[model samples]
Target: MRAIIQQFGPALESIALEHYTPASLSSSQIQLKMRFSTMNPSDLITISGAYRSRISLPFIPGFEGVGIVHQCNEQDSAFSIGDRVLPIGSAGAWQSYRNIDERWCFTVPNQLSDEQAATSYINPMTAWLMLSERLQIQQNMTVLINAANSAIGLMLVRMLNHLGIKPIAIVRRDNTLQEFEGCKLQRIININNRDDYHSLIKMKHHIKVDAILDCIGGGESLMLSSLLKEHGQFINYGLLSAQPIPPQFWLERPDINFSYFHLRQWIHSAEKIDIQNKLNEVMQLVYKGIADTKISARFSLKDIHSALNYIQTNEETKKGKILLTF
Candidate 1:
């Protein structure tokens, strides 16, 4: 199998594509013929040695993939030889094949294509958990999302619209406003220009916000918390800016609530049955087009270096996920 290996992390150009044998497929495991893989922001961090998890040298690097089961152990599983599945893992996803535990592999809805299913697990699942589970959003309530041009951001916007709620999209560039032009949105604000008081005016003009979903953490997180209604909730799911939320920001506001979310940790903590059930709910939404997993760009497994570079330089235009297809 051809896999992207991090011999010793530096720039993405340093990642080497090489052949390797997969682990043994036990009675409880299945071999997946991977078709597509998604490039996440965390993938960059993992390769650069800045992420919280430390990976040893000469390791395959990819976390989520969509593929077909070529070989399956007949160990009372829900999967079959020809079933299309999404394999969620911490690494070894950027390859031609992956051997995953049957319990960790999930069957995607028939409506999604191979590419859509490939990018499905991470962003859409996070968006669903942020709104449906973590925040417990209700009808007519308002939510705030930073980096609203992203795939997850777009999905959250659509989900809120479906539930008769509102999403206030906070974007950095004026050009991104066009992406959500036709969609039903609460408001659109340029973060650099909008002040807390000014954003409060905009929030009041559109709708009273009940929650915040922040991916761009740093000073922006503090400002986002200000827009939330008194006693409202705030969930930070990513640190695209690679900075932490200050403790004083939440301490100063006694009425507001703040928390952080990580999908991998949540998955690890949950029972296998529970994780699969939650993933099914997220996939169903994607199948119905209530939420979409748009592929903004595609790259080959061999050209991962250029793919990483594109993600860095074209953050705005690359509004959705950058996928690697086999």
Candidate 2:
């Protein structure tokens, strides 16, 4: 089996392509031939020692992907050989093949294509959980999403729209605005400059959103708080700037309900049944096209470095995910 191994530290330098014999199936295990895995920010960031405390070394780093079941050891399992599934559990999606427990494997609906199924877990599930569980968002309420053109960001946009809620998209470039051309977004605010606070003020004048979904957590996060209503839900799901939201951010707006959401945390603690059920709901949403993202490009597993470089340099034009095809 061929896999992208992360044995050392700090992204591309320590990571390398390696071939090894496949490990035997353990108890309740199912073997899968991987089809496609996304180059998610979480996957890339983890290699940079972001979650070193919880994640062990010499580990595989992909969090979400799709594959066909090649072997299922359990006779009573819902999955069968030839079933296309998202064999999720541990982070090993970067490999051409993976051995995972049957419980963690989710069968992909026939309605979704292989590429769509590859991205099934992370963004769609997170978006659903946030809107339906974490934030007490209601119909007709307006919400602002920074980095709104991102994969998960787009999910939130479409899901919010489907639920009859207005979405205000905050993107960094004018070309990024093209991502929202077909969507019926309430407003699209392009922050061309670091000092572009006037556009924010104009949006505030029109409507103080009930919640704000912040992905870039630095000066921009603090600036966006002005658009949220008093005691509104201010959820931070990503730190794109690699800068933490300081203590003063809460002190400045004590009434704003600040919260940090990590999908890994929820998956670790939630009941297995609940996880399966929620994933099923997310799949249904994807089937209905309520949660959808464009595939910007794809790369072979050996070209991992090039894929990383592409995502880095093409952020302005990246309306969707760049997959790593196995």
Candidate 3:
């Protein structure tokens, strides 16, 4: 088997393709032949030594991937040999083959292509959980999402639109707006807009949102909070800005409440049936073309270094995702 090995912390050059013997499948596990795997900001952060967890060095790096089941144990009969499945929450997906617990693998719907399922889980599930669990939103309610150009952000936009809800997008660059030009968005605002912070607040007051999905922390979190209506929720799911929100801001805004969303936390805490039902709902929407995954680039496992280099250098213009294809 071949895998993207991170012998050192997540430096671009530190990741390399290495050959390893395949492990025997556990009684409750399945051996997967990977076909596609997508990169996330966390992958970059992990390699760069910026991730918070204490990851063991020399471990494989990858979280989401699409593959076919080559071997499975009878402990779970949900899938069969050659069945297309997607690995979620399991790391080391950046490999030719992976042995994953059967519970971590989900049968990919026939409607989704290998490429689409490859990038599933992290982004799509995050988006679904945000809308379904975190916000407790109702149809026709509005929400504001920062970093609207992100893969997860776009998924939220599509899901909200399909539900008859509106999504207001906040982006940093004018070019980012072009990606959602034809999107069924309620509003799109560039943070660099001439509208002062006060004007931005007044604008939000007109069409108040039920919640705010803020990926950009730091001062941006404070700004987004100021726009929230009374009792409206604020979900912080990412920290792309790499800056922490000042304590004073939260103290100053006593009326605004804050909640953090970690996809794993939500999934593990929820009922199994509920999780599967939500995932199925999102998958159905995707099958109907109400949502889609954009593949920005594809690379082989041997070219892992080159792939990381491209992602690190071109983070902004990297529309969709950079995936590793086996």
Question: Between the candidate structures 1 and 2, which one is better when assessed by TM-score?
Answer: 2
Worst 10 contiguous positions by lDDT, candidate 3:
1-10
lDDT of 1 at 215: 86
Off by over 4 Å in 2: 193-196, 202-206
Best by TM-score: 2
lDDT of 3 by residue, 25-135 (tens): 778788889988887767777766654366766677888888998888645668888999877764688888788887777777888888877766777788877776767
* lDDT (C-alpha, whole model) for all candidates: 0.77, 0.80, 0.76
Candidate 3: residue 210 Cα off by (Å)? 3.3
Q: What TM-score would candidate 3 get against the native?
A: 0.90
* Best-fitting candidate, scored by lDDT: 2
TM-score of 1: 0.89
For TM-score, candidate 2 versus 3, the one ahead is 2
Tell me the deviation in Å of residue 187 in model 1.
Answer: 1.8
